[model samples]
Target: MKKSYCPIDTFINVVKGKRKATIILHLFQGDKRYNELAKLLPDISERMLTKQLKELEEDGIIDRKAYPEVPPRVEYSLTDLGKEIHPYLKGMFRGGILFEKRIDESL
Candidate 1:
């Protein structure tokens, strides 16, 4: 199948969005519950977080599992592919930090 523009850019777009990568980083530790993620990412709204998580799961970057119980339970974890792309995400974060450092130094 033919792809539009740079495939690499498209791949990045899939996982890149406001607070999305940070969510992924948190998941890198292990599977996390809905409340756990919300607690970890307090800056993000519940609606936005829900949307981003659904998108990530759709993109195969993460998996959502629910267990039948009284209170209900759901957990999110990085799919194998998410782990594979995490190194690249780490590099991106490092580069961003460098850029911020450079700007601060110049100022």
Candidate 2:
């Protein structure tokens, strides 16, 4: 893979946007339908969600599959590369929880 000018920037580039990390974290469970993701991330606008999903897909972080039917069924799941990042994200989440607890105790 070609390296970005800055490695940290490259990481940020793929995981940029308000809900990108959350989206990835959610996909950690398993494949999810479009509506299911939307419901899970209710604060994000439809346009924003679509844009983020597209960007993640382009970055090779996630896979999007569409089924042919009366109403198209679409599902999103992490690609292999995406799954590699899951451990780091999970660690970060756990750290955040620990930090929050520390802060609460300090207060």
Best by TM-score: 1
Provide the global lDDT of candidate 2 against the true structure.
0.91
Stretches of model 1 off by over 4 angstroms after superposition: 1-3
What is the overall TM-score of model 2 with all chains considered together?
0.85
Computed on alpha carbons, the lDDT of every model, listed in order, comes to 0.90, 0.91
Enumerate residue pairs that collide in model 1: none
lDDT of 1 by residue, 34-105 (tens): 999999999989999999999999888999999999799999999998999899889989999999999999
Q: Per-residue lDDT of 1-107 in model 2, one digit per residue for the tens?
A: 23689987778777869799999999989999999999999999999999999989988999999999868999999999999999878877899899999999999
Candidate 2 wrong stretches, greater than 4 Å: 1-5, 102-107
